[model samples]
Target: MPTARESLLNAALMALAQLPWSGVRMVDVASAAGVSRQTLYNEFGSKDGLARGLARREADTYLHGVDRLLAERTGAADRLVAIAEWTVGEARAKPLLRALLTGCWSERLPVPRPARRGAVLSKAPAQRRADAGLPSPADLVAAVRDRSLAALEKGSRPSRTKEESAELAHRSEQAVRLALSYVIAPVGEGVGPLVRTAVGGAVGTTVSATVSATSPTAADRRRLQSPV
Candidate 1:
């Protein structure tokens, strides 16, 4: 069973599906959630607060899913590819999530803003968190990049130095940005190959650099050059 706040948020999403934000009424949302108008206002502070709450949940849910996917016991490149594909699929399904990730909120969607500088903060912790500024598209991309980098780092070899870690972060961002590109201007093909190319190429480059630097006196320089 959902809590009152959850119920209200769910109700608002349903309302949003059928009507534009301008068309959605507080009373209707409260009624749909089996609550009074006062309860709605109490829970969210206002309709704009509710919008922020909704956007917060959307971002939270998406990031949580990305974390879950990244937790799989897969190679870094495979994991990045998996996350990218999943992100594309999820963005296509959820309008709010698509808007949150891409920063392309349509007129029908609630393009929520943070609480004003001097506005009274909400008493509820959740509401307060929502009132805090939401992530921009760049913020979200950097977040996903960092999350991917962290996950990949955990499963990395012990021999990986700080330079390798930095390279890993760069590769992670490339994979993330490639995923974002698919979300923005998708072609017919899936995102897997492209993400793999980004991350996989980075892996080879790191290996080749590590080998060449470590084995200057090696007889087979061609083998040290590495392959994708």
Candidate 2:
């Protein structure tokens, strides 16, 4: 059987999913978990503490997927779209991801804003400092996509024909931007899926060499020739 602490945490996570973190209370969590408020207090110390734990538990899951995505040799544009789509899926499902997408938990709960402090505000200051060298999640995903695309091009051609360079770069930039817009902060309502789909389309166009011969597309293609 789960311990009272585990039960309370699980209840807290569920409540956070359905309602804003601020709307959740110890009494509600306790009631949902079939435990007493006192038990919750004894285990988590405060509402903020419970909220922090819940956020971390969810983030752990998110990072795992991101890590796997980065490790793959998928095309750059595909990687960007995959990251955005993954983010959208998580935001639609996980409370923590939704909180990130909605930017609600930062207001109600004590969850750390990654962009604000560089480290998840919930993490210790030392940890944040240590993580400062790493790119933001959105940026990291963009970089990975950029690298993967460049790798694909290199392996396919001894040297890119000038025409190919022009077309590919244009589409790749659009695709990366599309992915970043959805994954990053201030994600407006109804924009997530739209941006992801657009990114996917952009990737398809670029990878297929369907873009017109133009300077813009050429630049975008060259940009994809490296890790962002």
Q: Which stretches of model 1 miss by more than 4 angstroms?
A: 201-228
Per-residue lDDT over 67-136 for candidate 1, one digit per residue giving the tens place of the 0 to 100 score: 9988864666677788889899999888998888888989999989778899898888988998997888
lDDT of 2: 0.56
Over 111-183, each residue of candidate 2 has an lDDT whose tens digit, in order, gives: 6433333323433342333223333445444453455456546656556665665455444455545544554
* Whole-model alpha-carbon lDDT for candidate 1: 0.82
How high is the CA lDDT of each candidate model?
A: 0.82, 0.56
- For all predicted structures, in order, the TM-scores are 0.86, 0.47
- Candidate 2 error regions (>4 Å): 1-6, 17-20, 34-39, 70-73, 101-177, 183-228
Cα displacement (angstroms), candidate 2, residue 114, comes to 12
Steric clashes per prediction: 0, 10
Looking at model 1, report the run of 10 residues with the lowest lDDT sum: 207-216
Question: Could you tell me how far off, in angstroms, the CA of residue 37 lies in candidate 2 after the best superposition?
Answer: 4.6
